[model samples]
Target: MRPLPGLAAASVLLWGCGPAAPRMAATPVPEASATAGVSSALRPTAGASAEPEPIPAGRASPPERYDDGVDVLHYDIELALPRGSGWMQGHAALDLRLDRAVTAVDLDFSGLHIDEVTVDSGPVEWHHEDGLLSIPLGSPAEAGARHRIAVAYRGVPDDGLILGETVHGDPSAFVDNWPNRTRFWLPSVDHPSDKATARFTVHAPAEWDVIANGRAAGPPVPTPPEVPGPSVGERRTWIYETAVDHPTYTLVVGGADMVIDTVGLAACGEAPVSPRADGCVAVTTWLFPDSRAEGASSFRRAADMVDVFTDMIGPFPYEKLANVQSATRFGGMENSSAIFYSQQAIAAGRDIESTVSHEIAHQWFGDSVTEADWSELWLSEGFATYFGAVYFERVDGMESFRERLAGAARAYLTSADTLRPVIDRRGDLFDMLNRNSYQKGGWVLHMLRREVGDDAFFAAIRAYYARYRDATATTDDLRAVFEEVADRDLARFFGQWLRAPGYPVLSVSTRDLRTGLRVEIEQVQGDYAPRFHIPVDVEVTWDGRSVRATVPLEGAGGVWIVPGAPADARVTLDPDGWLLHRLHGSPPSP
Candidate 1:
C-alpha cells in the first residue's frame, strides 16, 4: 500500500489518526417497469425515445462459470434469545472439500460456543471459541469431492457485530461494519470475495418476528419431537435459500419484531425476473412497524430496476432479492439475497427511493458480480455509486447529474484520506473502500463517460454486464469490455487512474493582450509520474460576455493564444472534473 503523491501523502500524515471514512449509503430497491438499459442511454443528449424494448422471461442466460468451489458446513440454527429465556440449539451438517485428504476439518468459531460435536453420528474431537475448530473423523477426511460433518452449538450473539476495539471497550466496539464481522458470529467464508450459498432454519421466540434472505417457506411449525433440541415454547422459523448465480458473501439473515410486507413480483415483459424458470417471481420485504408512516410503497420501481439491470447485464442471478430495513451499523450492506438498511433511513423522512435503488444495484455489482479481490473494490463500489447517480439523472435531469458529479469531485479532492489508489491490494479494507472507492470511483466513471463518447461507453457497460453477470470479475476484465466498445486502447487511461497514486496539479499563467490572450500552463506530477494528459479550461471576459477555450496537456506544460483578452480571466483544470486530479492557479484577472 505505497502512498500516492497527492492524497496518498495526506493519508500517511493521518495513518493512525483514524482516516476519515465516507458514509456507505443505503441501497434501495428500484421500482418496476423502467427500461433495463444503463441510465446513460436515457440522457436527453442521447435523443433517447421514451419507448424501450422489453425483456422476456425464462430464456435465462447462464451466469459466468465458476468452480463448484466447496462447502464446509450447512447450519440449521434454532435459537430463542429474545425473551431472555430458552436455549440456543441447532443441528449442523458439514461437508468438507478436499483437494487431498489426510487430516481434520476446520470451522470458524468466534461466536458460537460448541456444546456438542459428532461426526457420522459418533463423538469426535473438537475445539470452541476464538475462531478455531478442528473436528476429527474415524478416518482422515479423505481427499474427495466432499465429506460430511455435523456439530451442534448454542450461545447468545452479542447485541451488535464485533468491529475493531474502540477506547470504550470490546462490547461497545462497532459491529456489522465493512469487510464484515458478523460472519464470525456464524460460519461462512467471512469475506465478500468468497461467496457460497447457505441455508438456514432459525428459530426465535414467536413474540418476535423474523426476516432473512431467500423466500420464507412456511410459518413456524413445532419442531419435530425426534429432533435432539428442545421444541419448548412458541418458536418461529425462517427459510432462506440462495439465488442462482448469487455471490456467496452477499448472503445475509437478520430478524426482529417487525411488520412484514409481501409483494408478488409478476413478470411483466418490462420488469426483470429471477433466473429460475418461472414466469413471475414473488418478492417480499419487512420494515419496522415504527417506520411505516411515510407512505404507501410498492415494488414496481424495484422490479423495473431489476428489469433494466437484467437486460443490460444478465437476468437477476439469485433465487430471491429482499430489501429489509433494520438497525444496522452502516447505511446499508449488500447481504446476498437480503439487504439490511439502517432503520433511521425510513424513520428520518429521507427519500428512500434512491436508497433502495442503490442497494439493489449492489445485487448486480457487489453481490452477484463480485470483485476478485478487495484491491479492485471500486469495481463493486464505484459501479454502485455511479448507478445511484445515473438513477438520479433519469428521475431528475442533467443538472442533477452535473451536481452529483461535482459533489463527488469536491468530496474526493477535499478529503485528506483520498490519496490512495482507486485500486488497492492491502490496507484497512474499510479505509480503502471509503471515499477513494466511492467518490473518486465516481470520477473514474465520469472520465469513462467523457472518453467513450456516451454511446460507446454505455453500450460497453451494458455489454460488460451481459458478459460478466452473476460471476467474479477483475479490473482487467472490465477494461477489456471498454477497449472492445470504444475501439481504442485504454491501458494508459486506467493505469494513471486505477493503478497509479495521486492526481496531477496544474499552475496556469496568462499575459493580457489587446487582440488575443497568451496562456502558459505548467504541470507538475506530484510523486508518481511527470507524464500525464489533462484538459485545461480557460475563460476570458470582455465587457459582460465571456469566451472559453480548452487545451489538453499532452506533456508537462504548453502555451496557447486566444483572441481578444479584454476584461477578466478564469482558468480551471479539468473544468468538468472528469479526472480525480487537482489544480493550482494564479489569481483571476480583472
Candidate 2:
C-alpha cells in the first residue's frame, strides 16, 4: 500500500515507498502499535536489527518455489491440547520426502512444561534448550524418509503476548505480531520464511469452544486417564488439525464463545469472467457471539466479493475460510484459514463490513503466497489495500472509490514520519512503513495500472497469482508479471517508486502569446534529492472542445510553448492522482 500525498494548498506532486528505518522485537509481543502514533524515526535501521537465526548448516531444506528437481509435497498435522492452558500433547506424522539426511528434528515450544519426548512411541534422548524441542538420534534421517513422533509436555502458557488491555479485559494480546507467538502457542519454525501445514486438537474447558484454522472435523472428545493430562472442571481438552501448508506468520489460534455459520459454493452465484479462476473456493467465518448481530449482513455479502476476487486473481486455496472476531487489539489480522477480527467489529455496524473484505483479500497475499520476508510487506499490504478499494468501488460508486483513495492519500500525506520506504528489509511486522507500504504502495499500483492500462495490470496480477501460488516473491517477481503482460519493460517505473525515497514537486507557469501560447513547468525534488520522472496531464480549451496533452517533468522549473495554444489553458499536475505525492501551484499572474 502507498502513503497518501499531502493535501497542501500547492498542486505539485511527490511520491516514495518503504520504511525509513527498521525495528526489531526482543521478545514475543503483539505489533499493535497505534497507526496514529507511529513516527518515521521509529522505523528499524537496515542491518541494525539482527536477522533471524540462520538455519543449521546442513539440514533438509525446503524449496523456495516449484523448481523442476525440488521436492514438493503436502502434510497433515494432528494435535491434542489439555485444559487450563497448562500443556498440549500431540503425535505428528510427517508424510514428506527428505532430499538429504536430517541430523536432528527441531520444533519451537516456549514456556512448555515438557515431560517426555519420544520417536515412534519409544523413549528418546532429547533436549529442550534454546527454545527448540529437538531429538538427537545417532542415525541420520535417510533421504525420502518418513517418520512419526509423539511429544508430551506441560506448562502454564506464557499467557500469550500482551498487546494491550482490551475493553473486556481478556489480555487482548496476540502472538507473532512483532515476535513469534507460536513458540508459546505451538511448536514449529516461527518465521514467515518457514511454511508448513499444522493440524491441532486442543483440550480445553467443556464450556469454552476451541477455534483454529480449519473447520473442526468433529466435536472435542474427552481424554482417557491412560494418557497423563490436566484435571477436568478446571479446563477442557480438545483436538484440531489441518493438511494445508501456511506461512508461519499466517498461523493463528484462539479460544472463545462463537457464532458459527457455513456456506457452500453453490449458494454464491457464478464467478465473473474477469475475476480469478480459483475465486470459487467456498469459505466460512466464525464470529464471536457478540458479533452475531451483524454477522449475517457482513458475511452474507462475502460470496460476491469472493467471486470478484477469485475471477480477478485465483481460487481460494483452503478447504474453508473464516473470519473470527476475538478479543484482539487491532481492527483485524489476516490469519491463515481464519481471519481474527477485533470485537469492535460488532459495534462498527454495516458501514464497517468492508473489514471482512480486507481480511479475506489477505488470504491470497499474506496467507497463501507470503512475502519471503517482512521487507516486501508492500506486496501483501498494498495489494490488500487496493483490493479493498476495488470491493468498495464495486459495491458503491466512483465517488465512493475516489473518497476512499482520498482518505488513504490524506492519511499517507499527513503521517508524521513520511520519509520511510514501503519495502523495509530491516523493519518488523508492525514497523513504521505503514504509509509507504499501505498508501504509497497502493498509489504505485494505481499508477502502474494507468501506465500499462487496467486490462494488462489486472491480467498480470492474475498471472502472478497463478505463477507463485503457495510461494514467496520479491519486487522483481512482481515486475516480471507486469512485463510479461504489457510486453514492455517496467524496471524504470517500479525502480523509481519502490527504491527511491521521495517524490517530485511540479510548479506550473503559463503566458499567452498573441499568435500561440507559452506554458512553463518547474520541477523540484520532494522528499529525496533525485529528480522524478512523472507523467503530467495538461488540459486546454481550444475552439469549442477541450484538448489534453501529456508532459514530462523537466528541470528545477521549465517552460513550454503551446504552438497552437488553446484560447484558455489550465495546468494540472496529475489529473488522475495516481501518485500519492504532494503538489503545488503558483497563483495566476496578470
Candidate 3:
C-alpha cells in the first residue's frame, strides 16, 4: 500500500524528486492435539494457547497477535449491492479445518446484522458483541476435522467497504481491507497468518461493472429471484474465484460504471502455473470514464512491470492483474491480483509510476508471502519500497535507482520516526506506517544487498520467496534463508539495522602526511545508538588521478592511510551511495 498524498508530498520534498508512492479481537480456543497427517508448518505454534499480555495503559498492541484455533481453507462470499444504497446484503460460507476440539467458534465481525448462521447447513445458536461473532457448534469437532459454516448478514458498513462517489462523482463501492478491516463486512479469521482461497459472487445493478480478486468465472449472469436479498431492481451477479490462497486483507470487490482496457499480456517464462497455457498473465486497467485516457496511460507499462518482477522474483502469484482507479483512502492499495489506486491521482494526471510499481511489488511480497505478525510489516512495506526502486533500476538506469534510494534515506534521517526501529513493538497498527517501516526498512534491504554480493543476495531472495510463497515469514525467517544461501550468519547486520534504532553517524577528517593521505573516521551517533560494522568506501582525487579504498570500520572509530597520492587531494565518502549514514562535519581538503 502506498502512503497518502500528504505523506507523498513530504517524501518528494525530502528526496527533492518525484512524488512518493505509497483490527480485531478474537475468542480463545483449546490447544490442538497431535495430528500425524497435518503439516507442522500449518499447526499452531507451541505458544498458541497462552493468553496475550495486557497492553499498558495507552499503548496499542499489534492487531495480528491473536489466534482463533481454526485454519480457514476457503471462503465463498455472495454480496448484494444496490445502486445508490448504503445497505448491503451478504452471504459468506467458510470452509475451515479445526486445530483443536471445541464446541464453539469465534470470528471477527462487527457493525452488521446477522440474519442467520449455520454450521454444516444446520441452524446454530450465536452471539455477537464487541467485534466478535461467537457460534456454539452443539458438539465438539475433533482436531483436523473440517466444517463448512455459512453466515447471512446485512447492514450499512461503518468502514472497510467504502461506499462513495469517485473523483468524477460516479457512484462506486470499493473494499479497503488492509490490516484487519475486512471484518466490517466479510467475516473470517481476518488475520494475515491464516490464508484461504476465495470466490466472490457480487450482485449489483446491471449498469455497474464489478472487479474483484482472481479470474472471473464467466460473464455476468442475471440475478435469479431465488437469491434472497433486498429487492434491488435489474441486478446481475458477477462471479470471480481464486485457487491460490491469500489473506483476507487482499480479498476485495469494486463496483462502478467504469472504462476497462486490456494492456497486453505479460510473459511468465515457464512458471509452474500461468493464467494461460502460453505462460502469460493478462494485464488490464479499470478507470472512471472521465479519466480513462490519463489513467490508462499511467499504467501503460503495467504488463512490463509484471514481466520485470516475474523475472526478478519467481513467478507471478495470481491468475491475472487488474490496476483499478478507485476511491481508496491510500495513494494505492495492493489488493492481491486487483490493485486499487487513488482515483484523484489518476484523474489529476499525476506521475504515479513509483506508486504503481510499489503496489505491484506487494503482490509478490506483501500479498503472496505475507508477514505472520504485524510487527514484521517491514517484510511487506520495505520489500515493496526497495523492489519498486529496483524496477526503475532495470527499466530506467542505475542513477534513477540511486537517486530514489538517496531520497528515501533523506526522508528517513529527517523524520521523527527514525528514533524507532524497523520492527517496532509499540503504537497503533496504523502508527507502524512510519519512516522506520517504509524508508529505513528499504535501506536495510539495500545495505543487506551491499553486505552480501549480488550473486548471494538475489539467490537468497529467490530461495526465500520459493520457501514462503504461499505462507507467512518474519525477519528471522528471511535472515535464515539468506544465511543458508550466502553461507554466512548475518545476525550483526540485521540486528544493528533492524532491531536497533538510528543509522551510523560519522565525523570524518582528512590530512596529508609525508607517506600518503590520512583519513580518520569516528562514530558519533551517541551512546544509545549501536556501534555499526560498516565497510566504508573512500575515494580520493588529485591532478586528474583518482583512487578508491575500502575501510572496515568497527566499534567507535577507525583510520585508513592511503599509500599513494598528493597533498592536494579531495576526498569523497561512500561515493557509490552504498551506506545509509550521516556526516557531521565537512571533510578536510588535503
Candidate 4:
C-alpha cells in the first residue's frame, strides 16, 4: 500500500468507519426474502442523516486472535457484472478444512442478498446478519474434515469492489480490498491469516478486457446466451486462477477497455533457458489508451525492478506481474500478481518510479511474506520501504541510498505519529499507516543493517523470506532469523526501536582537554523516550585532517575522549546518516 504523499493525515477521516465490528449470528433469511435486492442491514436507517462524529485517532484495535475455526483452502468465485445497474450476481464455492470440530461455519459477508447455500450439494440451514453468514453443519465435524460449500448471492456492493467510470470516463470495475474490506463483495474468512488459492470467473461487457490475479486460464470466451443475467449486448467471461495461496487483501480483478504493453520477460538475474522458462516472469503494463505513452514511460523499468528484487530477495512468488493504472483508492496498491496505481497519477505523467518500486517490493514482503497481526505491519510496510531504497542503492549507488534514508528520517521527525511505537497494538488499523510503520520502520531496518554487517543482513533477509514465503510472520519471527545469522542477542536493539515510543534526543558539547578533545553526549528526550544504546560515529577535524571513531553511548549519556586532538577541532555527529536521532543546539559542522 503506497499512500499518496500527504494522504496519511486524511486517511482516518476518509475511512473513519475502520474495521467492521466482530460478526454475530442473526436470524435466518426467510424464503420470501431470497429475491430481495439488498440486505436491509446495509442501508442507512432512520435518523441517519446527521453528520457522524469524526473517529478519534489511535482508536482502532486488531482482533485478539486470527483463527476463526475454519481454514479456507480455495475460493471458486463467479460474478456477473451488470452493464448499467449497480447490482450484480455472484456465486462462490469454498473448499475448506476445519481447524476444530464445530457445529456451524461462519463466513464474513455483508451487503449482498443470499439466494441459496449448499454443503456437499445439499441445502443447509443458514443465517445471515451483522456481516456474517453462519451455516449449521447439523452435526459436529471432527478436525481435518474437508467440505465444499457453495453460496449464491446478488446485490450492489457497498465497498471493496469499486464499480464506476475510469479517469477517461469509460466504464470500469476494479477490486480494492485492502485491510479487511473483501467482505463487502466476497464471502469468506476475510482475514490475512487464512490465505487461500482463488479462481475468479468474471462475466462483463464484451468490449472490456479483464485482468486478475495469476495467469489467465485462457483467452476471453463469449458468455453463453443460455446463462441467466440481464441482457447487455454481448458478454464475455474471463477466467483466472492462482496456483499459490495469498491473503484476501491482495486478491483483485480489474476490467476496462485499456491498452496493455508487454515490457519483456524478467529473469532471475540470468538469461532464460527458453521463452517460457520457469525462472522468468512476464512483465506487462495496463493503462488507459489515452495515457499509453506516459504509462509506458513510467513503467518502463517494471521488468528491471522484478529482476533486482528477485536477485536481492529470493524468487518472484507469482506467475507474472502486471502494473495496472486503475481507479485504486491508494496511490499504489500491491495486489499480489497485479499491482494497481492511481489513475490520476499516471494520467498527469508524474514520475512514479519510487511509488512503483515501493509497491513492487511489497510483492515479496507484504504479499508473499505477510504480517500475521496488523500490529506487526512493520514487517510488511517497513520491509518494502527500506528495500525500495535498497533498489536505488543497487542501481544508483550508496550516496543515493544515504540520501533516501536521510529523507526518511526527516519525514519521521516531522510526522505527527512520532510519539507512537512502530508496533502499536491500539488505534484504527488505518492509523498504522503512519510514519511509525513506514519511515521509522525503514529506519529500524537501516540501523539493523548498520549493526549487522551487510553480508549477514542480506543473508538473514533471504533466510527470513525463504522461511515465511507464501505465509505470515511477525517482528519476532524476523528477529529470530537475524539473531540466528548474526549469532547475537538483538532483544535490546529491536525493543528500543520498535517497542519504544520515541527516538533518542541528544545534546552534545565538545571541549578542549590536555590529553585530547573531549566530547560529552547526554540523552534529554524526557522520561517517555527510551535510554537508547547507540553506536555514535564522531568525526573530529583540524588542520586539513580528520579522525573518525565509533563511540558507544549507553544509558543516560557518556563521555568519549579523542586522544591527540587539537583544542580547536571541529566535530560532526553521524557523518554518514547511520543513526536516527535529533541533535540540540547547533547543527553538525559541515
Candidate 5:
C-alpha cells in the first residue's frame, strides 16, 4: 500500500508487538445502566457548539482517481523473485481503454527500477519520478481507444512487501498494504477508487510456497530462468487469476513454508446454492508446516463462516477463500480471495476463529465492492468487524455476541475524547484504521440494523452487495441503499453518527408519576453541533414486571411518557443495546 506523498509509511503494530492484552478488548461488566448511552450530564467539561468543519479539500486529499481520459482494463503481472536478495523483477502488461483523448497516462509506481517501457508493443517516452510514472502517448490517443503498456522493472520494495524471519530462522515474507501501500510494490493506479481485474505469475524458490490474491488457475509450473552465474536454488512459477475487480491494496504476494489444504464448504454450515453460481465453494488454508495441525485446527470453522456470511448477504463473491498464516503486520488482512494473518496471533490460537471470520467478511465488503476512498474505509473494516460478531453469535451464543458488542463499545468510548468521526479524511491514511473504523464503525452498523428491523436491515445488505458487487462504493452509496430498503430518510441518522465527532452522552432522569413514568433524555456529548436523531428505548421495572417503549430522543433533550408502569419504577435507558453510549442519572438537578 502507498502512503500519501510525504506522509511516513507505517504498518499497524501487531497485537504481538503491542501491550499484551486480549486481542478483543472488553473490560468486565461495568455499571450496566450508566455504561449504555448515559454519562455525566452536568460534569464540568468544555463543549464545542459549532459543527466540525467539513474536512478541508487539501487537508487529507483523497487518492488520485485519474479515470477521466484513460481507465485500466486489466493487469497481467509476471513477477520473478530471486531468493535471499529481497529483490524482485516484474514485467507488467496493463490493458487500458481510452475514455477520451489522452496525451499522457499517469500510473502510480515507486521503488522499482524500470528497464524497458512500451505502449501498444512499441517504445514510448516515459518519465518516473516521486512515485508517479508518466508515459507520453506521442500524440493524443483517440477516444474509445484500447492500448496496453508493458513495463519491465526490478527493485526491492521496502514497505509494501517485507521479508520477515521467524524465530527459527525460517525465511518468510508477506505483503502488508493497507490504505495506499500498493505503489511501494506493484505499479498502477494504486488508489481504491481505480480498481482492475488482475492476474499474477509468481516465481519463488521451490522450498517456499507462493501465495497471491486469487485462486490458483492451475498447478505450479517450473520455470528455470537463465541467471548470469550459478543460480541460488531451484525456482518455480505459480499462476493465479482473480477475475473479480478489486483495489490494488488487495493484491498480495507471500512466500513461506506454508502448507495448503482444502476443507468442505459444508464445514461452514449448510451451504446455500447460488442460482447462477455452480460448484461447492471450497475453503482452503495456508499455514506454516510446523504449526499446520494447530493452524488448521484454529481455522476449522472457516468454511462455516463462509456459509454464514453468504446466507446473510448473497452468494460467496470470490472464486474461493484462502486463509494464509503470514508475517503480515496486521492481525489479518482481507486481501481479496487470499486473506493473510499474522503468525504471532495464529500461534496463540486466541481469537483465531473470529479473525478468520473477519477476513472472510471482507471478501464481500472490502474485496468485491471496495470503498471508493480511504475516507469511507469503515464500509470495509467496520462491516468485517460487525459480521465477525454475527458469526460469533452463530457459532457461540447470544452472550458472546453481546460481549463482543460491549467490547467494541468500550473500546470506542474509551477513545471518545480523542476520537474522530467514522468518515474522517483530515488525518493521515493510517488514521482510518483506528477504533472508529473497526469498533465504532461496527457499532454504527449495529445501530443502523436496530433502527431498521432485522428483515429490512438484511434486505438492505443483500441489495447493497448485489448492486455493488465487483465495483466500488462510498458511505453515501450505502446510506442510500439502506434508505431505499427501509423506505425512510436516513440522512440525519447517517450524518450524526458518521460525520460527527464523539458520541451521544445522555443524562437520564425519571419520576414515577401518576400519568405513567415521566422520563427525560438529554444529549450531553462533548460537541453540541451533533444532536443525534436516534431511537431510544426506556425500560421500566416494578413489582416483577418489565416493559420497554420507544421514546422520542432526537437532539438536545426530550420528555417521554412511559406507559404500562407504576409511578415508583426503576427506569433503564436503552436496555437492549440499540444505542451505543454512556448513560448517567441526575439527582433531579437541585
Candidate 6:
C-alpha cells in the first residue's frame, strides 16, 4: 500500500512504484561482514516454531471505525477469470467471530453486482449500496458466537486485480490492493485491522499458472458439486491455504504463463499440509523464459540474502517465499509469502537487491509485524528502509551505509512540503509514504542504533520482531520494547525525534583553557523544532595527537570540558555522522 506519497517497494534505480518513479542508479553490494554480536538472533534453539509472545496492547484505543461488529477469522474464496470480457464470477465464504449482537453485517464493497447472500446455509436478505454491503442475518448473533457468511457475486473488477501483458506479451494478472482496493473483488471487512486466514480456489485456463498466499493445497482439484464453484469455463480449481493469519492487503494472487525456479529452504517449514514436518521453506521464482537469463541474473543472490537476514533476525517466517517478476503498480509488492516485482527491474547480470531485500525485510516488519494503524506507517516503511540500509552495511562497506542514510536525511531536510511528524496523523493514505516515513524514518533507527550500542540494538530488533510477529503493533509498542532493552525511559528521545517536526541545528563555540578545552554547543533552532538529547562524539587534537569520546549533550545547550595537553588544541564536534542533526559553529562536522 502507498505510505504517504505512495511508495514502490525498493531499489536505487527503482524507487517505490516500479516504472512509476526513477531514482539514482544502482550500487553493487560487497560481501557480508563476519558475524559478530548479532548472531544471537539466529540462536539454534529459537527456530521458526518458537511461539510469538503476546504483544502488549497499544496505549491508544482502537480506532472506532475499525471496530466492526464482526471479526473475520477465515476466508474461503473461489474466483473464475474468463478471457476477454473484464467480467468475473466469485463466491466468498467468511468465518466470523461476533463481537456484539447484530442482525446485520456491513462489509466494504465497491462494485461486484452481487447475486445473493447466505448465512448458516440458508438464504438471507442483503442490500448493496455505495462502498458497502449490508447483509441481514435475520437473527442477531450473540456476542462471542461464531457464524459464517457467504456471498455470491458476478461482475467486473477492472480497477482491483491488475491485469496486463508482460514483456513476452503474455497475459499477466497480479493483485495490487495496497491502501484499500480489495473491496473491488472480495466482499469482506477490507481493513488491515481485520486479519484472517485465507484459502483461495482460482479457476483460469489450464495454461496459466495460478498462485495465491498460502502453500499449494495439492494439484488442481476438480471443482466440487458440493458448493458453487467457478463454472465460467472448463477450468481446474487450484486451491491454496495460509497457515498464518494475514492482513487483507498482503493477500495476493499471481496468474500468468511463466517459468519457475524452485529452491527449498529446509529450515523454515513446509505448508501446513504436514504440520509436523521440518518447517522447510520453499523459494520459487517466476519469470518469462525469454527473460529467464536476466531474471536469473537479477535474483542470483536471493538465497544468500535470505541466509543473511535469517542470521540477523530470527528464522524465516513463512512456509515459502515466492519471488514473482510481473507487471505491477509498484516495483515490488510484499504479498506475504509471494513477493511480486516489476518486470522493468530485471537487468542482465545485475541483481535488484534493493527491491528484493526491502520486500523480504517486510516478511519480518510489514507482513508479520504489521502496523496497528496507518498513522504508524513508519514502523513498516522506516523499518524496511533502515533494515535495507543495514543489509547494505553488511554486504557493502560502512561508507555505503552512511551514504544511504545521508541521502535520506538530505531528501527529508530539502523537502519543502514536509512539516508533519514521522508519526503522522493525516487521514490521507498517500500522505504516509513521504520522505519522513521512508528516509528520515531510517535515520531515526540509525541514530537509535548509535544511541544504544549495536548489541542491544540488534537484540531489541529480534525481540520486537519475535514479540510482534503475526500481530499488529503501534509506534508506542515499538518504543516500549526498545526502552525495556536499553534500560532507559527514552521518553525524551522518541518524543523529540518522532513527535517533533524537524531535526536539531547546533551552533558551537569552543574556549581554550590552560589545561584543556571548554566547548559550548547551542541549539540554533528558532522555534517549532526540538532540542535533541544526543550523545555528540567529540575529537580533541593537540600537539600531534588526538583523543575521541562521546559527550552527552542535553537540552537547548550544553558545554563539555576536554582534558588535553595544551590550550591551542583543536576541538571537533560529532567526528562521525552518528546523529541526524545539523552543525554550524567552530570546526565543521558532518
Cα lDDT for residue 174, model 2? 36
How much lDDT does candidate 4 score?
A: 0.79
Stretches > 4 Å off in candidate 2: 1-102, 119-150, 159-179, 219-229, 232-243, 262-283, 294-297, 347-351, 526-529, 541-545, 554-560, 563-568, 585-590
Higher-ranked by TM-score: 5 or 6: 5
* CA lDDT, every model vs. true structure: 0.55, 0.56, 0.80, 0.79, 0.72, 0.70
Clash pairs for candidate 3: 2-22, 3-22
Q: What digit string (tens of lDDT, one per residue) describes model 6 on residues 1-590?
A: 22212323443233222232122122211222322211110011111121112211111223676677889999988776654335566778899988998878888766556666888778787877666688887777798888788887766564557656665566666777776667777887877678889988776655667778878765664333323323334444567898888888788887776667764353453223223366556666776555556666556556666666777877776767888876566667788888888766552223566777778788778888888787777888888888877777898789988888777777787774246688877655665668888877888888888888899999999899889877889888888999999898877888888887887777777887867778777888647777678888878788789887776778767777877646677777776777877666432222
Compared with the true structure, what per-residue lDDT tens digits does model 2 show for residues 136-170? 54588777765555555444445332233233233
Evaluated against the true structure, the overall lDDT of model 6 is 0.70
TM-score, cand. 2 vs. native: 0.75
TM-score between model 1 and native = 0.74
Candidate 4: residue 297 lDDT (0-100): 68
Worst 10-residue lDDT window for candidate 5 reads: 36-45
**TM-scores of the models, in the order given:** 0.74, 0.75, 0.89, 0.88, 0.84, 0.83
Q: Per-residue lDDT of 1-590 in model 1, one digit per residue for the tens?
A: 11111223443343224322223222232222322221110001211122112122111112221122334433333333333322334345654565565456555444545555766667777855345466765565555656666665544443233222221111111124246443344543344444455555654445445555555554444433233333336544444454344443454455555555544463334224344355454455655444443312533376556655555555565556666665465567766557666544444434456556667777778776788766788887888788767765766777887787777767766765445678875544556656778877767877888877888988988777778765678889989999999999999888877776666677777887767778787776566544566566666555666666677778678777877664255544455545556556431121
Query: If the candidates were sorted by their lDDT against the true structure, best first, what order would they fall in?
Result: 3, 4, 5, 6, 2, 1
Per-prediction count of colliding residue pairs?
35, 70, 2, 2, 17, 12
Residues 97-169, candidate 3, lDDT per residue (tens digit)? 9887878888878777777799998978888876778888787889888999888777777678887777667
lDDT of 6 at 244: 84
Candidates in descending TM-score order:
3, 4, 5, 6, 2, 1
RMSD of 1: 14.2
- Candidate 5 residues lying further than 4 Å off, grouped into runs, are 1-68, 227-230, 266-278, 416-419, 512-516, 562-568, 585-590
Residues forming the 10-long window of minimal summed lDDT in candidate 3: 39-48
